[model samples]
Target: MEVAPQLRPRAGLEVVAGDVGEAVPSYAQAFQVVVNIEVKPVATVPRRTPGASEEADRLWLEHARTAAVIDDEGCFLVRGADRDWVRVRRTAHTALSAALVPGAGSMVIAMSPDGRRLCALTEEDDDYWIVVHHFEDPLM
Candidate 1:
């Protein structure tokens, strides 16, 4: 699948820590890649709840340095440090896609204090996987 142009890493930036798994070979790690990355855990909402994605987004706007909204169809709309939002579409079979399915477990949204990174934690079958995206610049 093609990743949104905005989601691509900027020049001089690389995946310094995480393993780019079979999925897309970019920033595809199932676990958090900690490299002196400090984040504030904002909220955890049950995915089974109605409008869970919306709730996540709302919390993100209030607490995140950056935030991403993942729809059930595997579409990602990410807001960077600039407060500008960009979008990407992913295949439906990915772990994130599965976790967004109705009746799935909870999702936790976290962000760096500097507003340069955003982490989304999704639960699947009692297992939680974290996907982190980093921005080249800090929040304006």
Candidate 2:
């Protein structure tokens, strides 16, 4: 008997631009990519409580939704909560977002030739670090 092949799941990044009031307060801008970039709102969470509205929760979600950016090459630049960059593969169905990085500031600089590592420039002492992000899809 012949066995059927299994289909693998797809994943990608979803980025949204939040309103100025909703964006998380930061001394530095939220997103900055050296390469070509596009910012779009990917998702939003409705007010959970019935007949209730919490501005804080709504604002937090808005900020979370705004911190992701993807390039044509399928690499993603996600700003983590600690103000560090989290690089990941751009999956088709999976939605990912990053919070503000800590310290003065940081930004994504470049992608490795092998498309495996990401370079980030930190504001403190003008330092830089290489980060490795694993993609769910090997081809991506």
Q: On a 0 to 100 scale, what is the lDDT of residue 132 in model 2? A: 22
- After superposing candidate 1 on the true structure, give the runs of residues whose Cα lies further than 4 Å from its correct spot: 4-30, 34-40, 66-99, 102-116, 124-140
Best by lDDT: 1
| Sequence-dependent TM-score of model 2 | 0.23
lDDT of 1 by residue, 17-133 (tens): 222222221222212332224533445555567765555544443433235433343344332334233333333222232224334544433333333455665554433334455
lDDT of 2 by residue, 79-129 (tens): 433443333444444421122133434333323223332333222222222
Question: lDDT score of model 2?
Answer: 0.29
lDDT of 1 at 48: 60
lDDT of each: 0.38, 0.29
